[model samples]
Target: MSESIEMTAKAPVRSAPAPRRTTPAPRRRSTRRGPLHPATWAPTTVLVLILGLIWSAIAAEHPYILPELSEVGLALVDRPEVFLTNAWTTLSIALAGVACGAGTAFVLALVMSEVPVVRRALMPLAVVLNVTPVVALAPGLVLAFGFGMTPKVVVTAIITFFPVLINVTTGLRAVPPSVLHVFETLHASRTEVLWRARILYGLPYTFAALRVVMPLSIVGAVVAEFVAAGSTGGLGTMIRNAASTARLESVYAAIACLAAMGVLMLALVTAVERRVLFWHESQRRAST
Candidate 1:
């Protein structure tokens, strides 16, 4: 009986299943896509290509109409003195005008922020000034300021002011609720809140508005020169000379110079923006 019981146990043990082997689970990979930002060179690249094609076509037919890029380049190189002097004159006026306009706008925007009643009073007045038409008003400005930089500067300031005012006001109003709440919790005074919070927050917008106004101010200065004509040797005067003499090429060259000036001024403003507001979203976008 003992031997039979032992045999039964051994037989059950022998029939038991073999040890099961377990396999490790497969690892999963993350399939997230990276940032899909556009490149800065894309637009400039396309513009250059289009300009080159147009230039080439012009060069092929009516070569005079399509002055050789090389010719224009040579003209730039050969008589840089004329271009540089005229550019300097125009730029000085433009900078002066920008200063006046920006200062006035800053003060006005601050005042408006503090006194909404003043804003309501001044807004319609500003609109009347803005839509009064530059060509018609420019002659009157020249008549008042007497055919010198004074008139040009005044015209430029007039044309340039509204943009700065609008932008600065908008910026002053952009103070975030969270920031305001923080100020309140700290028991900050109204002046402190404005100087520390509102102005700081509005800086980017102020710069953006200046970027727009700077170019327009240039146009304004040039227009004033047109009205004050025959006494000045500005780019505007150069245009008149070319027009009177029927030198279309020279006129085109002057126009090109004006374009270059606008580009340079705008570029400088953009650089300032990048430096001053490196943390701002706009700067990040421009960089990308």
Candidate 2:
């Protein structure tokens, strides 16, 4: 019995059966394409194809009504200086208007977001202004501000204002209840909550509005240029003068420039949004 006990004691003790190593269920790889992925360019490729088809159709069927794409391109090549100068004029007006409108809207949105009563009082007035036909107001604005860039900038600002206001206000209030509770629990001040939480959350919405307003601002500037009696330069003026003279190629060239401008602005805003919101789920998924 002593020998048996000694033998048993001599036998090496086993560790509690080694815990099974869990290979974490292999994380599922996302099938979604990143921005640079070829698949993400497919829509743009399709759009180019569609545009090519339309160009072909227009060239074949309505040769007189609309000049060939080549003619439009030639117009641009022929008078690059003219187009560039007018484009600069229009762009300046748009930039000024966007700055004014977006700045004012941001300040107002901050106030309205913080004070519900202000939002309630100002929202209807904003809606009325939005609904009032901007085209009708163009002449009056020109008359008031004169035939200079002031009227055009004002028109652009008015057009760009409401979208930013509405979007920013919505974004400011979109904080998750639980997240807000945590902020409150931490005794964060109003400014701290706004800057750290609300502003960050609202960035996506603000960018979305910017994408829209940037293009819309150009349209507003063009509209103002149309009505401003003494307006001397701009794509709108170019288009009007060209159309009056049946210069379809020039008209289309100006239009193409406008389209390019809008696309460029949208691309800029998108790039900024991606950079700013890299941490956002939407952008993260897009990156994936």
Best-fitting candidate, measured by lDDT? 2
lDDT of 2 by residue, 70-139 (tens): 8899999999999999999999999999999988999999999999999999999999999998889888
> lDDT for each of the candidates?
0.82, 0.92
lDDT tens readout by residue for model 1, 51-127: 98898788778764556666667767787798778877877787888889788988999999999999999989988
Off by over 4 Å in 2: 1-38
TM-score of each: 0.79, 0.88
Candidate 1 ranges with C-alpha deviation above 4 Å: 1-46, 59-68, 285-288
* Residue 184 displacement (Å), model 2: 2.1
